[model samples]
Target: MDQGTQLLLILVVLLVLFLLAVIVFVLFSVFMKRKNSLLREQIETEKRYERAIAETQIEIREETLRNISWELHDNIGQLLTLAKIKAQNIEGGEEMIEVAETIGTGLNELRALSKSINPEAINGQSLIYSLEQEVNRFNRLKYLSADYELLGDAVTIDSKVEIVLFRIVQEFMANTMKHSRASKLEVKVQFKADALEITALDDGVGFDSENLFEKGIGLSNIDKRAELIGADAKISSIPGAGTQLKLIYPLE
Candidate 1:
């Protein structure tokens, strides 16, 4: 080979290697850009979900307060009115005793319902306390046998998160009472350093978890509300083994 021919071949080889290196860099840059865009899109979607959940929570709380007001007026108020009439009637000692019992029962009902009427009260309290109140209400109302347990040291969580969590559990309890036909229900709350786990189990006639979305709007809402607060929800049920729901919320 001549000197000029050897130099020309060397330059061509160098040019080819430079072109390949440029192609590889461009491909890598494009891939990274696409990946970053996808990640940003995911974050935005989650933010939207959280906002929707918050709005829904507010609406639900308002409706709940309204219902509580009606119950106080229509149910407990009527009981008090009857008791007063019985008190005014100087008929018999047995009649007076019945009126006293009625008054006592109404007072008990009011105390149980009072804790659930205020969103601020729920936010100010620990999640475990809120769950215990719910369980007590179920038992008091003769809806079902409900119990709650708290494990590990309690961690202070965001109030907004607590409200959402409480609402989610409330929905589950309502379902158990109305549809589960189950006699007993249990709720367990576990607090860890990085996360909080809530588990609810009911010994009721269970349905297919795989088709939950098709089952009822309440179930879907329960899952979505948990996700709004950056929590993971898992629901499982067999034909007769009863339904179990687990939610895990990570701490900041």
Candidate 2:
């Protein structure tokens, strides 16, 4: 080959190799970008699915509670009323009078349970009002001495957030009643300009707080629900002191 021809061929080969390298680099960048986008989309889809499931579960549970409340009010409550009336009619017997009073008390408790179980009690009213009713019912039933206090001016809260918070409080109360063997439970709520804080404390037998997440699903559930609402949950306990759960939710 002639020197000029050889030089020209070399130049052409170098140009071709450079074009190939550029094409491969561009393709790799595109592939990486696509992979990252897909990953983000998948993560979002999973989050949405989890949120939907949580909402559905709450709805079903509330519906079932409503049904039970109705049955307690209309059926068992009536039967107790009838028994009390019959007991009242029995004269010259102190035992009969006591029986009537007992029946009446039972009737009163049923009515309260009915009101609490109805989903409307929480949905139709504010969170503060709902918590007040729950605390009153607990005291009336003598299940446990429960108290609620509110601080600061309350701000309007989203309904979804209210429901989730109410459920979380209920879970804590249930745990206390069933296992804590505590005589008193107190709940405090503080409203700030841009956030809200809730603290639930029970003077009961407390467990190890360090392993709370590993203990059971109930504790983990509290964490999950709090996260869904962009809140932070802190649970602490002392073996002899007590168990306390605090949740802080940003309003904005």
Candidate 3:
């Protein structure tokens, strides 16, 4: 072959090779982009599924609580009322009068409990108000010296978040009452510019926080619920000292 023709052939082969290289690079880029999109979508779908499940669980729990509150207010409450009425009617018996008064006190506590457990009440009122009712009930019943405080100006909160937060606090308080054998319980809510912070502390005998899962104190459940609502939860305890739970939730 002539030198000119040979040179032209070499240049054409080089150009073809370059074109093939460009095609491969473009194809790889497209594939990678598609793969990344799918991966992101899968992650998002999983997150959404988890959130839906959490919400459903919350709804079911609230419904159950409401039912219990209704039963307390209607059934057991009626029975107590009837007993008190019968006691009051008993003729000139000092013991019967004392029994009547005791029954009245029991009725009062039951009413307060029903209100506190009622989902409708919690959903309708501010977090501070709900917390106040809970604290007042605890004090009235002498469940322990319990107190609730609010710091900073109150801001409007979503009802869903309110219910979840309230449930978390209720769970902690119940645990404290049942297991902590604490003499005092304090709960505080602080509204900040960017976040809402909640603290619940009990002066009860504490346990090893490092073995929280082993203790089965519902800490994991609390953490999971907090995560679903975009909140951070921190719990600490020192044996023979006390246990404290702090939760921070970002505000939009």
Pick the lDDT winner: 3
TM-score (C-alpha) between model 2 and the true structure:
0.80
- For 142-242, candidate 3 gives per-residue lDDT tens digits of 87999888899888888999989988888888788888989999999999999999999999999999999999876657897788788998889999999
Best model number under TM-score: 3
Cα shift from native, residue 227, model 3 (Å): 3.1
For model 3 the local lDDT of residue 45 reads: 100
Q: Is candidate 1 or candidate 3 better by TM-score?
A: 3
Can you write out model 1's per-residue Cα lDDT over 140-225, one digit (the tens) per residue? 88868888899999888877788888878888888888778999999999998899999999999988888888877257777777
Q: Model 1 has how many clashing residue pairs?
A: 0
Model 2, clash count? 0
Q: Cα RMSD for candidate 1?
A: 4.4
lDDT of candidates 1 onward, in order: 0.82, 0.86, 0.90
Worst 10 residues of 1 by lDDT: 111-120
Q: Poorest 10 consecutive residues of model 2 by lDDT?
A: 212-221
Candidate 3 residue runs with Cα over 4 Å from true position: 92-94, 213-220
Error of 2 at 206 (Å): 2.2
